[model samples]
Target: MSTVAANAPGAAGGGLEDVAASEASLRRFLHGLPGVDAVGLEARAATLGTRSIKTTAKAYAIDLAISMIDLTTLEGADTHGKVRALCTKGRNPDPTDPSAPRVAAICVYPDMVATAKAALAGTDIQVASVATAFPAGRVALPVKLADTADAVAAGADEIDMVIDRGAFLSGRYLDVFNEIVAVKQACRRADGTAAHLKVIFETGELQTYDNVRRASWLGMLAGADFIKTSTGKVAVNATPPVTLLMLEAVRDFRQQTGVQIGVKPAGGIKTTKDAMKYLVMVNETLGDDWLSPHWFRFGASSLLNDLLMQRQKLTTGRYSGPDYVTVD
Candidate 1:
């Protein structure tokens, strides 16, 4: 039972290799995690989605959602121009309204991290990079670890890394676990102040609510500062039900270890209404502490625009269009 909690912010454990002295112990630890009742999970999310918020509450939720966005551009054809523009957008989402809160960070490919960092200078907005071969994670371990180190070197304030779903699906659980540990270590800067890490599970491919739950615990145990739901590359991404389940995981993890890991729901969440539903889930499940940008985030690109528009409507009492908001 002597666990090594590598990457666990303040956890008391030995090291990565000691967490599970044997494969059998790792399996026992993962399997012993509480099971997910898919039906109940989905039903609870639906019920939380039904909670009504009036004008003031809606406006507050809109602003909170804005602050929680990791304004992202992770396309194959992404460029410095795109990353810089996204950084500008993240810093001042609403040009007409300076009252608008800035997003938590600008998310980009590892190569674009410096561009984003330069563009967002003097602002608290962080520059995050997606590494570890990103969306696919089919590359070799050395390649993945180098990918993470390169991002950290480029001044990424945070790293969003994808787990090797291939290994996880193949039942190489320790491979997946050790990979997270290595990537977390890669986040450390020479100053010893490391970039925060968010581990993506690609829940859609995992194919079951139970798998998502297990992945959540696994990431937490591996020392992920945040557990992310998806990469937005997949067809099914960031559903309210899946996100709600993740919120539950963070809440439970905090209760057990006293380490409050963050949660992020990436992809397909496009509207302020959709964002509010997630906020409701957080408020209900994890309470006010996790409601801020520090503890929660929306790994989104388009979600920022929608939130801006809604914030405009709440301010001016009229709906706005694409013309008013900057197109990233």
Candidate 2:
């Protein structure tokens, strides 16, 4: 709902060229390093677990984007049925009938935007669609903008646009920056309300802490309301370390410009414990200001069930069935 003016005052100017050079240098350093192993994952996970897990009235918001309900492996009718079922019942997966936190939005590809719109018609939940050749973002600029426009016109409340990382990594920072601004411009809603734009950095592809920071700043300066990680389409996706860096970027940006931006760490997050770690990071690193669903979201499909299961465990002292907690 925040309007990020294209010509916002603090827009990255001379510093962008310097940042781009730093990003390239950092990328090369990361590329030369060896791949991480299970030990590293365990160490990081353990370190995060040591942090607090108490739920506040202000819990971190989650965006469960049902990217694909088995694309080629499932029938369209079945997929639609499953999505509808999830929206109708999967939101609150409690057998005891206690209320649960509703997901922030339901994200799907543009083709399913209308279906999602229809399914979530009366609920406060929003409908988000991935446009501009999501997961790759290798399309023409005009076509990408048109894709974003069409999705917004089709009742999408949020638009998740992927950055042209290829261009960015190739040293064309301005091109990538302008592309995001253009797509953001095209996402104005029918009643003149504009859809929130979440720029996916695809951090896995970017591959470094410094480059991630630069990309985060670039996306925010180019009018992104939220800076998201990954599309869940690549071999590597959002991880804790990458998210930690991005959160720092958002925090720094807010301090400098007084503009609060949101962060959505998507992909590879599959458990209540994993979700808790992210929440802990947001709390510790970015402070409580970014704890709300508006400032933070988990772009996940299976995370809700895990959170419910854990909450039930905390209350009833036993893990409930998948049916006991709704899944769609």
lDDT of each: 0.84, 0.68
Candidate 1 C-alpha lDDT tens digits along 30-121: 77777888899989999999998879988888888888888899898998888888887888888889999999988899999888889998
Model 2 per-residue lDDT tens digits across residues 286-313: 8878766667777776676666666666
Best by TM-score: 1
Error of 2 at 315 (Å): 2.1
- In TM-score terms, candidate 2 sits at 0.80
Distance (Å) between predicted and true CA of 249, model 1? 1.4
